[model samples]
Target chain A: MKIKGKTWKFGSNVNTDDIIPARYLNTIDEKELAKHCMESLDINFSKNVKRGDIIVADENFGCGSSREHAPIAIKGCGVSAVVAKSFARIFLRNSINIGLPLIEIEQTDKIKNGDEIEIDFENGILTNLSNNQSFHFSKYPEFLQNIIKNGGLMKWTAKKYIK
Target chain B: MTITEKILANHCGQKEVVPGQFIEADVDLVLANDITGPIAIEEFEKIGAKKIFSPEKIVLVPDHFTPCKDIKSAELVKILRNFARKYGVRFYEIGKVGIEHALLPEEGLTLPGQLIIGADSHTCTYGAIGAFSTGVGSTDAAAAMISGKVWLKIPSTIRFIYYGKLNKYVGGKDLILWTIGKIGVDGALYKSMEFTGETIKTLPMDDRFTMCNMAIEAGAKNGIIEPDEITFSYFKNTLNNNIQNLKSDSDAKYEKTIEIDVSKIQPQVSAPHLPSNAKDVGEYKNVKIDQVVIGSCTNGRLSDLKKAAEILKGKKVNSQVRCIIIPATQKIYKQAVDEGLFDIFLESGCVIGPPTCGPCLGGHMGVLGKGETAISTTNRNFIGRMGDTKSFVYLANPEVAAASAIKGEICHPEEIK
Candidate 1:
């Protein structure tokens, strides 16, 4: 499967609290959370972000809290996928469990905000459509592939446990 | 195998396990709090599972935003209360609840050689007692609740051996802060931090908890101390006669080993934005603060209160500084009151509150506004962590928090004169 979107660039050590502030944690609704996504770091994020926009960030993206709201809000706000140099462990798991695609690539500095990019997940290739430069990331393992194919862990669990 | 490895291998029914191996392990306990619980419950419902795998093994606490910060928070806790009733799980109410890390261990729930998972990042605190515990996301909690199992990738170990005698002001909070300062926040990412040494052997139970609690700050999967006589003594009254503790084998492999000399270390204070920005408290002299908070899952224990009260006794909090002291759990609160620590806090113009995680997560009770600064014992001074994004936070131990309250500025306890 292929994903295409313009980029929203961020810096190193971008934490979950910066993704969605604790003040907005009162709700579990993705729509409500989406309204405040990245309000603390970039207050204009939610207001300006369009659906299917990709996030390109430096290392340690989504550090700190284990609150899944960070991923939920980003996904809810129509950020199609996140590509970072690295990710905090819990945030990575949450995004995967919720079926929000994440890519880890070296040299994220070359990517800039509003730079259109295209990803071929099945083939593990990402091309910055703006510059026509391509990068590669490790392919997802078989089990992860199954989870993504099932649309998330919730649906995967449902298919397994629900009669 | 290391103690962490032993626990993880035991849970997965593996005779031997190595780092980087993926295993489906059975969890002895699954935890979620008010913030994560409602979301996990939502996922659990979506799964349409037959029933909770083991209701008795599920623990829910509403400490993050307790006593209902607002309508939405109340609705969130209401969902937790209703779910607890439906499933017969152990739930802590606002009055009885404390920070999940302090509350669980105080109630004797955390034990050695158990595989525990929680939906809060600080869940790694349980590793202090020799349990293989780590934080997960909400949906992972839901998945564990349904099957009593979790998927895990074993992490290699990083051994931190601390020696030398500690100074009066230095304690677990400072040691952990120094470690984080030494290794950047992501230094130990996806690694287990195995803390051992002459200094750790003499460290108090509360300090051990404090050290392990911040492992996540260093990007560690967990921080653990080998269960020894001290660990056994901690659980002597709480656990039944069957006590089998695990330790790392003599030749246990570690990805890296670090040695910290405690004698030369000073009380540390993590500056704003990142825990890795830690330094000696003397580096931040005369840095005035608007508030002083001496509580949270981190340093809100009885001993922490005692340290704060020791410094605050016969002194008054600066008129400009609003000092908020919260005991982590009901039992700890009662103990502090019984020990007259509450009177000292109140006499010093400090406000003592219930067993809520208030103000720690910037949830409620005393949140900061724009451009305000605070010196707190709570962990994590991230941007907007305790209020407005423009606000600043400095992290220190209970002694520093109390002493800073008296001066309205960041200063050493010895400098209070």
Candidate 2:
């Protein structure tokens, strides 16, 4: 699948705290979490993030506790894909399992915010629509790609195992 | 390859593991606490996981809500109890057992070259004794409960070579806080941190566990130290000849290697907002503290309490600073009382609670009022995490926290000691 969107930039170690503050964790609702997406880092994150936008960050994106809410909040906030220099292990697995497309770019610092971008997972390339530049990332495993294609691990697992 | 990689390689049945290889590990064990076990049990039921993958492979600890604080939490513990009985799972509801991570390794549940998954983030604590341990989501944890093998991306290894001598009052907690400051939160993301060097040999088992316990805070998959004579001695008393020597190859390759000089280090604190936003306690002097709580999976060991009790023995806690002490488990709590540590705490006017998660998870008790500041040993001081969104929590070592509690202000341990 291909995705096209504007980009939002973040620095290194953007932890679960920055995504959804711990205070909001009492609830399991997705919309409630979206309200506080990036609340600690940018109080106005909900207002600034447009639907289907992408977030590019430095290394260690989504560090901290194993809060699935962090990725759920980001996806609920209309983030289409997250292209980071690297990702925390649990967050990476959880994000992909939840059907959020997260690509690990080699040098995300070079990309600027509000830059239009096109992500082609089929070819594993992210093209900078504004600058007409492009970057490559590792290909997602076929099993993981199938899970993402099915909208999440739960959905895929349910479809395959439950039924 | 480092100690972590060497262990992972053996567990995954690989001759060797380099970066970026997806390997499925043979999960030697799985653990869950009261807070997370109920959810996992629910999911496990959904998957119809009967008899578990192996009866001996799973351990259920009724921590977090041990005292059965409220009906809701009490009900959760009940569900875990029923699940454990039905599945033949080993359950440690209360008494002698304290902290699952501490007890598991002590009981020979953890060993070198094994993979363990716990439903708590501090599950990384097991790595200090040379096991590949990491936290998992309740559903993911439930899945592993049904199938003892978990998937993984054989993480790259990072080596930390420690050198020099630590000054008095400088303990394992301070070293971890200092390391976080140097590497930033994500420095070890998706990597296994292999801590080595002569300095590590000097630290006690409890201190070593403290260092590895915070590995999760740094986004590491796990943190490990090669088992040595110190490790053997600590386990020999409990393990009954199960203690084994596990070390990395001399030529083992590491993705990255870092050298930390210990002599220059001092007491460090993670300022409000982020664990990576660290500063020496000296820099935050005079920052008025409203609360001081020490004890968590992170620093709740006997050694930590002994140090804190020594500081509070002759002095009263600052009236303005409400200090609370909650041992990680009932066993530790009993140990404290038997040692007359409770006398020191009570005389110093500190509030001691039963062995429950309490304010650590911000579920109940110890909730800070708006705009108040707390110096706590518990991990994660995010906004509103401990009570009020406006309230701030500064994470510090037990020594620094004790000193700050006595002074009613943020003060480095060195200054008071």
List residue ranges in candidate 1 displaced over 4 A: B237-245
**RMSD in Å for model 1:** 1.2
Q: Could you give the C-alpha RMSD of every candidate to the true structure, in order shown?
A: 1.2, 3.4
Docking class of 1: high
Chain A TM-scores of all predicted models: 0.96, 0.93
State residue B232's C-alpha deviation in candidate 1, in Å: 1.3
Candidate 1 TM-score, true structure as reference: 0.98
Predicted structure 2: clash tally = 1
- When summed lDDT is taken over every stretch of 10 residues in candidate 2 chain B, the lowest stretch is B237-246
The most accurate candidate by lDDT is: 1
